[model samples]
Target: MRKLGCKPAVTRHNQPRLSGLRMMARKAPARLVRDHIDPAPLMLANDQIGDCTSVGIANHLRATASLAGYQIDVSTGDAVRFYSESTGYRPANAESDQGGIEVDVLGIAGRDGYHLDHGTYYPLWGTVDPQDRNALALVVAGMGCAYLGVQLAAADQAPGVWDTDRTGDNTPGSWGGHCLLLWDYTGLGDNDLVTLLTWGVRQKATWQWLHSRIMEAHGIIWPQMVLPSGFYPTGPDLDMLKADNAAFLMGNLWQVPVTS
Candidate 1:
């Protein structure tokens, strides 16, 4: 399969590393999960020749915005246009129609700002790593969703069933590269399964399937305002706040030290 021109070379330093911290696996009640972001309004009907990357990113932004109480309608056409303009990848060329680059699409979203009905937009943080079930679960439960880049075999794409039992080798050369979004994940350890949105439908696959086939996995950070009700702030968020408060207290403008 053709690779996107904007696809960056995978490197050790940039790859996602599991947070080593242990986290409890709690499944949100089916009723409460239904109340979270809905995939129906955000799915793409059909993407341009090689615009799956754009479609995945756009859908992710749209879903996160919806969770934040803002309705964002971004069509596949819009995503393709953004990718073309941001990456200088001409869509008209069949040879260069590949569009599965995360940085390019996320950069465009941050720069142009995702269109909202109220004329305000928010930025998203992109995180990449190998398969981390706890991290994936935390992101979906607290944030909105996670976007995944995987190497897919012809069979994996066909019925769209990505169970681990399907195959043994899931390396890059063993399959074609593709991008999709992970909206929901359940269970723990070896039993964990994630729900992916691709080509206008949701598909299920084990975390093992992801571990096997995922060349790159991106967890898009949702804005604080959009975090779900039961969400707890991650360590990074708390650390940033502490650092900011300390800096403020040390500055001449605010000499009072934080007692708490």
Candidate 2:
């Protein structure tokens, strides 16, 4: 594992915590599971939900995303609405810090060093994860780039698809409350998918559900793979900058299947 050195969020991988693992063993409907042979990605893009956590995660991710010239498409407020399901912009149930948001931010950090996407995470967070929305956020008090709260995701809902390896069945993904980090998108990216880390119990359904919903148009997502903190010298690289160490950055996403 990569020692976070300064980035606290980068500590853990997709591994689950002790208590959390036990909970899954006890609650997950493993016996009721009906296996799928050649699985097809579920078409459930119209049902994305967010907890107060995503608010923080999106804020920091917006910075990293900006570095990759891609946005994470997350928000729960009109000030930075990126989707119809956005917090208050919608007519159905506009709320704040709901969760499940994607975003895009930019940084001309030219001489000003690292600049966070005010458009994507302005009222949100900067210099630190304000409220534990993302892994980095959890380490707000620290100088590193990661934290425990950010490493945790709420928990297992129920596996809606063939997630025998993780979520079981008939559930909305993982259901529980735990911490996570934003590391290891490396593996998922290799599989043409994105990966994140959590200090709490790791649940495959969390990402799986996010994937299914994204494909279903339930929320904003990238058809292309979203990898963890890595290097793409050809593109905007945030991790390389030292002068802008604590500053923020932004990026844009390509090939996004949008309804609008």
Candidate 3:
């Protein structure tokens, strides 16, 4: 069985929501994953450590960077380092290897910033309702991708169109808590199909399956994915959101924007 890392979704007291934000692009394309990128999974050391939470973030950073006509070289060591720092996991201590909470990890990264090869990137993430499909689509269209935490079913281990498994071990969280990046979507209406980057490759799953298994979703706005003015390239008032996040989080959490 693959290692599952995400612990669970911890609700914050005053997290920002995208419900009222004005989206520059009302509709997202049927698909967002670029054709030039390879489907080969990076794995990012998740095969050995329960660091899917950090691995998911690393994958998003790479995907967004690639989509924007550049590259960010992320390594397994980077992922494992972030995981160890954020979740208190030690390579020599098995007891400290107990996964991590997705929101907590993101919140910490948002406050302290994540160090990458190029430089430190301060990613601004907000709570997104998993049940809101339109909101999710807008996120992918506007923010580039969505970070998702999901409960894995026993049948999910087989992989290939992770639709509902009626005749098998389909119980939510039966397997474990896992995390993935939702980067693309196709089709229309209830039949929409979404592509997830996880466990070292891209996987397809039905919208229904995502709706059923998803426990938490967040829209992450990478520093490099935005315009020079600190706004999202798609035109969301990212500066305003950042200001709100600064206040909602800790003391001057987002006092300065990281343009490097």
Candidate with best TM-score: 3
Worst 10 residues of 2 by lDDT: 214-223
TM-score of model number 1: 0.69
Model 1 weakest lDDT span, ten residues long: 251-260
Per-candidate Cα lDDT values, in order, are 0.54, 0.25, 0.76
Taking all chains together, each candidate's TM-score versus the true structure is 0.69, 0.25, 0.87
Model 3: per-residue Cα lDDT at residue 245: 72
Model 3 C-alpha lDDT per residue in residues 41-61, reported as the tens digit of each score = 479888888999998888888
Ranking by lDDT: 3, 1, 2
User: Whose lDDT is greatest here?
Assistant: 3
Tens digits of per-residue lDDT, candidate 2, 1-260, equal 11111111221121111111111122211121112211111111112433323332333344345434555543244212332223222434544323322221111111121222343232211222222122221221111122223221122333222222443343332232222233222122212222233212222333343333221100111112233422111122222222222233322222322231
Of 2 and 3, the candidate ranking higher by TM-score = 3
Cα deviation in Å at residue 45, candidate 2?
A: 25
Those runs of model 1 whose alpha carbons end farther than 4 Å from true positions after fitting are 1-37, 41-47, 65-70, 115-120, 167-173, 222-225, 232-260
Backbone collision tally, model 1: 2
Task: Note each model's CA RMSD in angstroms.
Answer: 9.8, 17.8, 5.1
